[model samples]
Target: MSSKINAALGREIRDSLREMRIQLSTLNHRVGSRLGLKDADLDCLDLINRAGPISPGALARRAGLHPATVTGILDRLERGGWVARERDPADRRAVVVRPVQERAADVLHLYAGMNRGIARICADYDEAELRVVADFLRRTAEAGRQATEEL
Candidate 1:
């Protein structure tokens, strides 16, 4: 009886996880479109948010975009007033691009919810088990990124 119940719960969890991922992805597409972001804008922002105060050329390289494309994205971002470019004080010829707000407050709220939700899901796991799960996910993501590079 106990074994059957556990197996059923496991299946439920797996299906629910898949459904939630799909829902979140669809929601992201909808919300991003509403916000006037291109399908690729999220990746561009993520790259900039991770390593900003950098130049358009460098941002293009890191985001796997052409320099001209990066310039276009930057122009849109600047027009939206979400980003700013300033001449590097040291070089006076170099430009720095940075987010106007570091992890915007609304964005932080969403992060908090996501963090708590994931923590709650893993609350049953011990630290060692959690470590293994985290490592596995990281490795899986790395494999995915590598596969993209190969294409």
Candidate 2:
């Protein structure tokens, strides 16, 4: 691609990413409300679910929240029956947070529509194209993490 074309493509990609972020934030807000969770609490829950048995400190760092804030979120989540804090088997002194499997289905149900839409969108692309898109998304996510850390 020519430099001019590449520049235009970059601009378009940036705009598309911004729009996607806004839409995802809105969706998260709705989901969080339905689950009786604050947006930050829901985000922490997601990080915990995906990371599987993570320490409070690790979750705070991953979620870009302070340790105290994470503790508060954990308290709410526990009271809401969304997650559990258990002693780490490897290190009895430490604690690890895990999602309560029984409630996982509720969260999944809320996101099912979006997941199906994403799957349908992916169906339009060939394997190679899908690979390219996946690679781009991974790189972009890493870039976002780095940017967040820098702030």
Candidate 3:
């Protein structure tokens, strides 16, 4: 493809990705509200679950939240039975946050429709095409993380 065409495609893809992110965030807010949790709390739970038993400080750093704010988020999550704080084995004085497995499925239920759609779309791609799509998504996700860090 010509460089001009490639550049235009890139711009279009970036804009679409931005809009998709905004829509996803809006969906998450609605789901969070339905679950009786703030969007930030669900975001915190997601970060904690992905990290798999992370230090409060580390979670706060990744979430771009203050320690005090993280504390409040954790408090609410714990009270809702969505997460728990366990003393870090490596550092007895420190606590690590983890998701409650039972409640995790409830969160996943909110994304079931999207997940099914994504799976159906992926079914149209062969192995090689799927690999390309996966690679593109991984690189795009990294770019998003970099952009978030910059902000």
Query: Total clashing residue pairs per candidate?
Result: 0, 0, 0
Name the best candidate (by lDDT).
Answer: 2
Write one digit per residue (lDDT tens) for candidate 1, span 65-123: 88989888888878876678999877898998887784355344544656788889899
List CA RMSD, all candidates: 5.4, 0.7, 1.2
Question: What TM-score, computed on C-alpha atoms, does each candidate reach?
Answer: 0.69, 0.98, 0.94
Candidate 2 to truth, TM: 0.98
The order of the candidates by lDDT, greatest first, is 2, 3, 1
Cα lDDT of model 2 overall? Answer: 0.96
Order the candidates by TM-score, highest first: 2, 3, 1
Best by TM-score: 2
**What residue pairs are clashing in model 1?**
none
Give the alpha-carbon lDDT of every model. Answer: 0.76, 0.96, 0.92
The C-alpha stretches of model 2 lying farther than 4 A from their native spots are none
Error of 3 at 16 (Å): 1.3
